[model samples]
Target chain A: MIELQNVAMSYGGGDLFSEISLKLAPGSFHFLTGPSGAGKTTLLKLCYAELMPSAGHVSFMGRDVRTMGRDDIAALRGRIGVVHQDCQFLDHLSVAENVALPLTVARRPLDARELMELLGWVGLKAQADALPPQLSGGERQRAALARAVIMSPDVLLADEPTGNLDWDMSLRLLTLLVELNRMGKTVLIATHDLNLIRAAKQQVSARVLRIANRRLQLAGADL
Target chain B: MRAVLALIRADGRGVDRVVPPTGHTAWLTVLSAAAMAFLAVFALALALATGRLADRWSDALARSATIRISAPVDQMPTQTRAVLEVLATTPGIADYRALDEDEMRALLDPWFGPDLPVETLPLPQLIALTETAEGVDGEGLRLRLAAEAPGAVLDDHTRWRRPLVSAAERLRFLGLISLVLIGGATAGMITLAAQAALAANGQVIRVLRLVGARDSYIARAFVRRFTLRGLSGAALGTVLGMIAVALLPEADAAGGFLTGLGFEGAGWLWPMMIPPMAAAVAFAATRAAALRMLRGIR
Candidate 1:
């Protein structure tokens, strides 16, 4: 339920992409692929209103994201779960508290049992009391994902969710996204791992959008 | 512990999760607050003392005037009697008393140490006059005194009273200025503390920003922290200062004037407000710093 129509993005006063467009439908799974410096992260930033388009509109649900107020944008973000590549966490807080941050910032109370179950979904239940610095990269990523989806957001956007993990951990993380997709959440993941995409295809009939020549294309047939 | 509880419950407006990176200045907070409170104690005393001085000066001056009759030793008693008769018929002069030998000796007791032989000495005849608030015509009374008792002179006590009143008023003003400076200094230190905290918490701020936390939410944390510290420190200082002020001597007749340079009854409550006022200053200063830093970030 996120759409980018003729969107152009610039970062630090340099154009990264222009006039590119894609729509993310409900319950759809899409893999965003691109070479290094191809603006994949920039595209996801546009989808979530973290970065506004320099020349065109990025729409979230039915409203134009470019024109929305900050409060409106924050409210919209509560419905879109984002797992950053860096997996930003308050190091002073425990993993469970970190995972529950989105809800806390939204002024919602935490459901302890439900949060533990979500933490367990990505296999991080035992590490709930551990701080971000105390966790491994894979564990941090899983915790980030659990944090992202804590509010039961309609859309899940992950940037390099499996980047720092081994093959087994990558598959385990993918299964969590796949499970979310199966449960009616739209998922768009930015990754360079083709093997992971191939693996994902075996489990879910997902589409692939490849960024090249500063444009987004359906790369499923080529794959 | 009490401060922590107030912060956690924070009136439901929400605690801002932002604090300065460099951390808190617990000692500085306490020190500045204590210092200001101590000085404020003096200021409160000065203001109260000035108020008392103003009342005493006005009271002693308002209804009183003096008459001094000087003449050759042979004519002294006759001139004094004539001056007294003239004063009794004066319109606004409500009452008059002629100071006798023993009364005049008592007046000179402080300076001459009760050693002067007053009865054998040739001293000026002193008449203390009480006037109605409406006041009689001093010029007409002086002319009458000159005609009836040529040596008699009327003194309104104006010349010396102005200087005394002015000196006390100046001390009161200086005390007030000290209080204002103390408050301003407290605010400045708190501002610097807030800025330092902002710099130290840069990473925490970056993380919060990336997570889409608003500037208001982050600033609230710092504002709450600094404000509580300021209030606590100021309160401690105020209590200590008040204790010190209470130990000061009272202004009885035996105490003279220096002992009167402190708070009277009911003037004790004025210094109690400094702590909260200091807290408000801290809250405003930190909130502004946090918001400015937040805006500078993406």
Candidate 2:
């Protein structure tokens, strides 16, 4: 679980957000909706300890992010999976290799059958040997999702995971995320897609939080 | 010691495959290490050769003196006898002998042609003297020679030997300094190459970090690759350097200094250490660069 109390972030004398308090409990699903420049990605970065708040404290599993060493942060990251908007993959590596990178970095043995099964579940079994540059947008997103869950992290943070996919692909990726949450993994997604939110709300109870006017406000009976 | 073992064992967990392959920096590291190692071999050879030359000059000239008797042709025999008597009475004089006509001819054979008439030309009579472990007092010997043989002069070879030995020692020092500079330059070049590789692979680093890779895991990949490259390149350079030194013309009496510039006896084993040394330098330089670069990210 991640907790931020009275947090504020700034860049070069310009304020991105201020006095924000949020808590992500265990096995809860949440959606963060904001405009393009409303600091949605910045908040996600803070949750993952990629960036520190200019003021106030952010803690992950009871440990303050500001006091953690580089190694400690790395260890914490292993317990939290993040899927970036760009689907950041090593362009030279094959799809299967990219999907299994989390396990590789953790120095764990890679079971070929499990990896193949995971790839088949993501509909990338045929393209396992293909490089990232050769994959379509939907394929890259699904590969990123598969990579994020390969470690079975307790929390998952995704940033615009379906920004480049079509309706069916977005719904498919959303179903995978929903399935992961149903398996007791906490998920927080940052997006501006209302239709996707409506579609997601039909299947699960997801609390919607929107960032407006440099403040985070819970929506009141709104889409 | 642990760092060395880590470098050797490496992360057999396929950690090195995370970073994409870089072409330019690989070639740069290998070629720089090879070139520096080649120069280091020659510097090593020069240092050893100069050391030997210094020792040889010091040992050969320290315990010997020469008496040159320049007198009128008629007084030569009397002066030679007087000098011999004085040397026989000296406490530190181990042995003394006046050179014969054939020995004198052999001494001057290199400067003058073999056909020169040595017995007829009124050259000075030369007497070679060997001293005991405690050498003779030059001033006392000169005073005695002047009283008994006025034309006799004692030369203990100090003036000639000191300058030659000093010059050889200085040359040896310079050779050692050259080796140090070469190693420093090699480290600088390898550091630059490692930094460039790290900079070019920023995306690889970011992706690895996001997936929970520690700094040590990331650094090991680069360190192993660069260290191996340095080892292979230096090995090639050292072998080629040894071959080039062995193929030089053999040292001969006519070719005095330059011909003797090479390893001798057990000295051949010295150049074999260059490859491993280069590998160590590469390992240190690349590890430092990788860690420093990783600190700046995230």
Model 1, B133-245: lDDT tens digits are 78889999999999999999999888888888788788778878878888888888888888887787787776665555666667777777778778888888888888887
Interface RMSD of 1: 2.8
Model 1 alpha-carbon drift over 4 Å, by segment = A212-220, B1-24, B118-122, B209-215, B253-258
Local distance difference test, each candidate: 0.83, 0.91
Find the candidate with the highest lDDT and give its number.
Answer: 2
Kindly list the per-residue Cα lDDT of model 2 for residues B171-289, writing each as its tens digit: 99999999999888988898898998999999899889988999998998898888888888888888888888888777785477877888999999999889888888888999999
Docking class of 1: acceptable
* Residue range A164-202, candidate 1, lDDT tens digits: 999999999999999999999999999999999999999
Tell me the deviation in Å of residue B258 in model 1. 4.6
DockQ metric for all predictions: 0.33, 0.82
